[model samples]
Target: MNKIKQGIEKLWAGPWVPPEHGKMPYFWLLSLAYMGWKYAYVAPGALELAMLVLTLALFVPLYLASFRARGWQVHACMLAGCLFGAAWVRWNPGAATFFIFACAMAAGITKMKHAMLAIAAVIALALLASLQASGNMRFLFLMPILTAGLPVGVGAVMDARLRRSRQELLRKQEEVEHMATIAERERISRDLHDLLGHSLSLIALKAELARKLVHRDADACAREVGDIEASARQALAEVRAAVTGYREKGLASALASARASLAAAEVALEENVERIPLAPAAENVLALALREAVTNVVRHAGARRCSVSLELEHGVAVLRIADDGQARSAADIRHGNGLCGMRERVQSVGGKLALRARAGLELELRVPAAVSSGMNP
Candidate 1:
């Protein structure tokens, strides 16, 4: 049973037919049924019937082979088909079916101009053969000529469109791959900055304080050194977690870190956070947004007081980070990579980020509650 199935598959596809092209070459042979008129009415001799059968046996392989042929090979196939039609049209008017196949195959040529020219020449040969067979250009003899022309125009147009669509699909695939690479690179850069920026700042402040206390107070200096060591270890762990794709800094930890970071910078911290249920993904996005916002406040806002707020409003998690620092212009905010990264992170999980600047800067993030994973409550 397996051998029989394999045999059937091989015969249907064949070695000569390109896998990309369509099949059913045998079905097209039915077009030669019109040849029954000559066999039934004219009663040709055995010699003529044998010659027609020989021509058909040879033409079948050539027709099948044309599916995988290229360049000049295609031209050779077309010429062979036309020659067969021209040679036998006087004995069998139905031989024009070969011309239809020849002109249709010519449409596969790479160059449109060349393919059209080849199709026109094959059609002209077919018409000439018909004219010579009947000895005139009468309408009765001209009917088969129409078959040659129809496939030429229709085949060329359809083949051209298929080629264009394939090329367009390839171009879109390349564009999507390029965009994915860029997005991955941006993610690494943004995560690294969000993970390390505040930690490094706090480390710097501790180092400065330790230096000042080293001469006047030994115990305080040692405590500052210990804090520095702890922060360094935590930053290293966060870096490894990020690399291994385990970097989900929850909203609670982010708020605690913000308080410490702001205190190190002598900036007052205020909060109105709620214990709203959140999916791990939405919580991670919001946490990263808060850290990045607070880092920006410490480094650029130079404000005395900064506020962090989180609340569930109508099944939406709304987070706001505002500071009473100097305001920045819209152009400056747009140009900053930190702000741009925050916006991208917010929008990635179907969230929105908005900015308002009057006496200071305010960043707002809203993520739908529909994505709740029911685990981060």
Candidate 2:
């Protein structure tokens, strides 16, 4: 009996069984009830029940498989099942359900016009079969329209909504990509302006002075030439600072950039940084985090002064960045991609970010020592 039950289970749910309390199994039972509704009034004979079981065998596999099938395969399964159901109608009135299922499949696979045309053809064939075997001619014609209408209409609407949703998602993706390209251009422009502006101007002035002094004082001319070389080296350092973004130049380089940026923004910055030995990846994360924190302070905090401090305690690294400007309300702080990105970067390294606006705007970022030592999060 147990073996028999297991075999029945395998057959009903397929050899590869779906999860427990599955909707697909319930749906199959509903289909069976729909196709056997006529027999609810009168008891079906043994032969009729046998034919019912046979029809179920043909219907179940094709119906379940149609969900994941595509293109002509889905159409083929629907057509095959519809034919079986329509044929079963010779012995039963309720077998009209297969045509309804087929209508839905058609509607899902193609546009409304094509689905309606295909359903119409199937309805005509079913109507002819009904005319031959049906006891009630009026019902035979009327029932198909009523049953097929609901599934087909619902399927068409669902298809349209799905198409619209896909289009909307695609539009959003494209918009994000365009914004990223614009941001990249702006970053490059800003970096170049900051990097070359001061150095280039000084180099040009020193070169002109050296040209003027060439006939007057040999010693002064050599000094101006030395100044030009120094200016060139300074320009190279600025370029290296921009490139340090990917090179993991650690907290010192990041702090230098932050100081320069803050000065550019007319914001006074105070720093208290302690040297902490961290793995390269951890250093890079902290550096990027410092850069982002300073950027937010400069752009949104509207603070006249900012301070940054780093410390280590109990196998954890703590960094704090605070600004004097609390112009914007904390309630208005929506953690857009910027803050969300910061959070993600921190969390990926087994760290957490804390934000508070009571005493101006402050950020506390913490990283575990395990992560800093190159351990996986």
Candidate 3:
């Protein structure tokens, strides 16, 4: 039962057809009511009935096939529909509906020049058919030309607009993906630098000391070498943890990264961070919030000079980022996906985000500074 229902549906609403149109393609077949009216008055003879059935058999396939056809194939389908109407119109006026369908399908053509040419050809064929059948150019005879030509013009314009909309959406999606890729790469590079920079420098310094003390003090030399080995092992472990996606660069590394990023964007940064102690979790949240705020400044704020400050007030950590960029009204500051995500992350760590629009944008984050006993830096 389901298979039969699906097959029936496929006859009109094929996979390529958008569901929003409903059953409009099938509903439009009611325009063939003229043939039934003609039959009610005079009755269709056996040969006339046969011709009608054959016309329907051929025309229905062409009409449905138009949904899936493209380029020259669409042109061929339109031409076939026009020819069918021209051939059948002499016996029955109801066949003019074929002309409407044929020209409507011309909308699928993308090129303006080609679509115009195709519509013109359909109109010419319709004109010739109507004139030949009526034997004269009367107002009634011109109905076929008007009905067919209007659909081609209107449908062509609609199709062009839909095509442009889809292209624009695709272009924006690509841009977003590219930006995300760049952000991920920058994050990995920054993490690597933060993890290795201090340890590598200390190891280098210890190795130099050991080389100098080798002859003068054997015990000092051995101690320096052991310290160098320990630093090397620690650096290796940190790198391994970084590779496994452990991105826990503390507040210091975050500020360093912000400086580099701002400098690259030609935006000067001023920092006044207190040497306050914070738990790892609190530091991570603040660092992420700081990074996001600075990134927004560089990418969207267009600020020349940015200020960053971290302060401890009543057991809460306050981080403020302000810039001297283009000013926008409060309503103009939309919390887009990036800002929304930043807010979510901050909130997850029991932090609050506040925004202010002055000469430029100012973002402030407040997180609890859960100071551990041994966390003095």
Against the true structure, whose lDDT is highest? 1
**All models: lDDT?**
0.78, 0.67, 0.72
**How close is each model in CA RMSD to the real structure?**
9.3, 16.8, 14.7
Preferred candidate (lDDT higher): 1 or 3: 1
lDDT for 148 (candidate 2): 64
Each candidate structure's count of clashing pairs = 0, 0, 0
lDDT per residue for candidate 3 within 1-377, as digits (tens), equals 99999888876565435453457767666755654555676788898899888888777777767766777899889989888877766666666677777777877787777777777777778777886566432334457558656675567547656866787999999999999887666555554554465455456657777898999999999988887787688678766765665644567766776775676466888988888788776786676567667767766777899999988899998989999988566874768655665676578679899998888988888888887522322
Please give the lDDT score at residue 299 for candidate 3: 64
| Candidate 3 error regions (>4 Å) | 1-23, 33-37, 135-141, 171-175, 199-377
TM-score for each candidate, following the candidate numbering: 0.63, 0.44, 0.49
What C-alpha lDDT does candidate 2 achieve relative to the native structure? Answer: 0.67
State the TM-score for model 2. Answer: 0.44
Give per-residue CA lDDT, model 2, range 1-377, as digits (tens): 99999888877665332342245434544855766676777789998789788878777777666655567786687678668766776666666777776655563454556656766766766666576574573475348657664566466437645765787999999999999887656544544443454456456656777898999998999987987786688568756765543443456766776775676567898888776766665665576677777777766777899999887788778889988886346795667655666676678678889988776778898887544443211
> Which model is ahead, 1 or 2, in terms of lDDT?
1
242-341: candidate 1 lDDT, tens digit per residue: 5665655577777877887888788998888877878777887888888889888888887999988888899899999999888865654644777787
